[model samples]
Structure formats: structure tokens, C-alpha cells
Target chain A: GAGVSQSPRYKVAKRGQDVALRCDPISGHVSLFWYQQALGQGPEFLTYFQNEAQLDKSGLPSDRFFAERPEGSVSTLKIQRTQQEDSAVYLCASRSGAGTDTQYFGPGTRLTVL
Target chain B: TQLLEQSPQFLSIQEGENLTVYCNSSSVFSSLQWYRQEPGEGPVLLVTVVTGGEVKKLKRLTFQFGDARKDSSLHITAAQPGDTGLYLCAGHNAGNNRKLIWGLGTSLAVNP
Candidate 1:
């Protein structure tokens, strides 16, 4: 793909429902990141992956948040028992290698828990 | 924890006016990057400053990294409506880790 792509641009889920958001990073990119951005706030790091190896999950808010990059090219962020507070835009970004490489971001999935 | 704080959470100015947004941190960084985001879209990288005391210019926009590598600023000269967006600053710690700490971001609105 020309750029990072996310699925379900907009989603509305009832409280307690589980939802999954997907991201397709740029071809052959080695680094992948997931972030959550609340209304009127900047994106907060959620997790990071280095070639299918989940190196960093320190930013995941709680047990309900889980992310995986099985093949290192596409990733999924799953939220279990979603709450009203879970409503936010989920963003995915990718970088080529490591140090100082620029990160390209996806359009993001806007999740609305009603 | 290393944190980046951005000033003027929101700014509205007339076209042709000049403005500057700042990002500050207490910890030093190896590199800092500036990004601009529009509504319904993800942020796009605008510039990256690696060396302390470095200054980079992108047409009407100018970016500077602090001498101590703990702060940075973005200045726009003769702003235009096209420049209206959310500006964010992110920095990588010097520990060789790839994690980036992001600022709160400055939302700028340039009205024509």
C-alpha cells in the first residue's frame, strides 16, 4: 500500500461490547506502534512491535487492551468489555528501521462506545 | 517520567499573522520531531531536529531545537489558512530505545 491503512474508519459499539481495529502498515516496515487519542488530546502510546516481536506493551492502559502483530506487516488492537471511557480514536504508525526514522501514521479508527 | 508540555493548547489568528508554539521538557532528548495533523486524518511529519541548537526552515515555517536538547519551538511566519491544524512535538530519549514521548499538541486555527 502507498500508506498505512486502518479498518472501520468509524465504529459505534454498545458498552461492554468487544471491538477490534486493524492496521496495515507500509510494506516491509520494521517498526509498528499503536496509540489512543481521546477527544481534544494528543495520541498516547499503547504498544510497539519490532518485526512481530512485541517488545513494548508498557503503555497499554489495562487488561482490556491487547495488540498483536502476527506477521509484522499487519496489526490488530482488540478491546474487551469496552466502556464509555474507552471511546477514542485508535491510531497506528510505522517506521522503517530504528533510530531517528520518521513514523508514518494511519488515518485511525474512531471508536464511539455508547 | 519524561514528558513534553506544549503551550497555547489552542490558538486562533487571522491569516498573515505570525505565531509561535513551544514544547518544553525537563529531560534531554537525542532527537525531536514536529508533526501537523488535520481533522479526521493522522499527523504528518514536518521536521526533525537531531543536534542541539539546530535550526531548520521549511518555507514559511521555522523550527528550533534548544541548546540543551530539552525544548523546541515552531514558528510560522505570515500564517495562512492552510496552516491550520494540530501541531505536535515528539522526542526520542537518549537511551537508544525507539520509544517516543509526545507532547500534548497545539491546535492552531488561521482564519482568512
Candidate 2:
């Protein structure tokens, strides 16, 4: 598909378990973003990557949350020692450039912590 | 910190009904966008209003950006069952180049 795609569309993890979610953005897209959305809530920005450089991660909830976009294309978000509060849908989006506001989104990964 | 507040958190109406959802913020924005998300899927961009007081329409949906760039609204006319989804509003932080502040979405359910 030409649009962004996320892997492991659903994940179930136990407390303290670590999990990694993957995102494949549209080819040639330069900006990538990760967001966490709780049930009934809008997506909250977690981090942003401009090519291979992770430009902003201030929105990450904790140190346990980490993301990488090596090769400047596919990205991954890893959360260590997961907590129940971490249960939410993780969404990935990519924009054509840093100057544009339109973002193409992936299907999102729903993480359920128990 | 920038924040967007949406009103009428949840709305349920029969097909062909009309409704409006609002997103308000105290901080100004460079641009505002509206998205629609279905269950288990990410949001799809519906419209982006760049100029204040700009109005855009797509089929039965009409979007308006406040003149102050601090608020926006979405109005649907003769809504259809296919319109059932979560409607979200996001704004480009005027202070940040790429950061977007999002508002709690309005859950819309159109009964047929």
C-alpha cells in the first residue's frame, strides 16, 4: 500500500514486559511521528523523527519509551517494563516534509497491557 | 502548553440529522486540521484550514476556522450512517514547527 503501515496491529503484554511496535511509512516521506491514543481520547504525540534524526521526544511519557527511525524510512517504538496505563493505540504518521501539515497515518497498533 | 478542547464529547443521532462539533483553544495556531477515525484504525485527514475565518466543504461536512485561529468547528448536514466515527481536531503549534496539539475527539454515532 502507498500509505503508512503498522505491524502487529494488536499486542497483548504483561506488566513489566517489553514490546516493540513497527511502522513503515510512505516511500520518500521525510517526517515521521508517533502518537499514543487512549480509548475515547485524541492521539497524543510521543515522538517525532526527521529522517534518521529523532528531533523531538519530549512528549514521551517516560524514559522507558523509546523510538528509532534508522535508514530514515521504517520506524519502531519500544516500551520497556510495560504498565497497565500503557495500554492504548500507537499511531504512526508521515508527512511529505517538515513544512507541510498533512500527515498520512498508519492503521495503528493497539497495545493492551495486563 | 497548548491545548484543544472539544465540546459535546459524544453525539448520537439518527441518519439524516444535523450536528456540529467544536474545538476551542486559548492559544493561536498556524493551521488546524480535522480527521476522522474508525474503530481500530488511524485517523484520516478530512480538511485543513490555513487561513482564519476560512470555510471548506466536503460533501455533507463543512469545516470552519475561527478568525482568531484559536478555534474551529465541524458541521454535518443530513448525516449518514457512514459518517459514524471519531472526529478529531489537531492544530499546528504556532511556536513549534512540527508539533501538533490534539483535542479529545468527538465520538459520533449515526444510527440508520
Best by lDDT: 2
- The 10 consecutive residues of candidate 2 chain B with the worst lDDT sum are B92-101
**TM-score for each prediction?**
0.98, 0.98
Residue range A39-63, candidate 1, lDDT tens digits = 7678899999999999999999999
Computed on alpha carbons, the lDDT of every model, listed in order, comes to 0.94, 0.95
Which stretches of model 1 miss by more than 4 angstroms? none
Query: lDDT, candidate 1, residue A1?
Result: 76
Tens-digit per-residue lDDT, B40-93, candidate 2: 899999999989999999999999999999999999999999999999999997
How far residue B56's Cα lies from its native spot in candidate 1, in Å, is: 0.1
At residue A15, give the lDDT of candidate 2.
Answer: 100
Model 1: residue B59 alpha-carbon error in angstroms: 0.4
**Candidate 1 all-Cα RMSD:** 0.8
Worst 10 residues of 2 chain A by lDDT: A96-105
lDDT of 2 by residue, A1-114 (tens): 789999999999999999999999999999999999999899999999999999999899999999999899999999999999999999999998988658999999999999
The DockQ scores of all candidates, in the order shown, are 0.75, 0.85
Worst 10 residues of 1 chain A by lDDT: A94-103
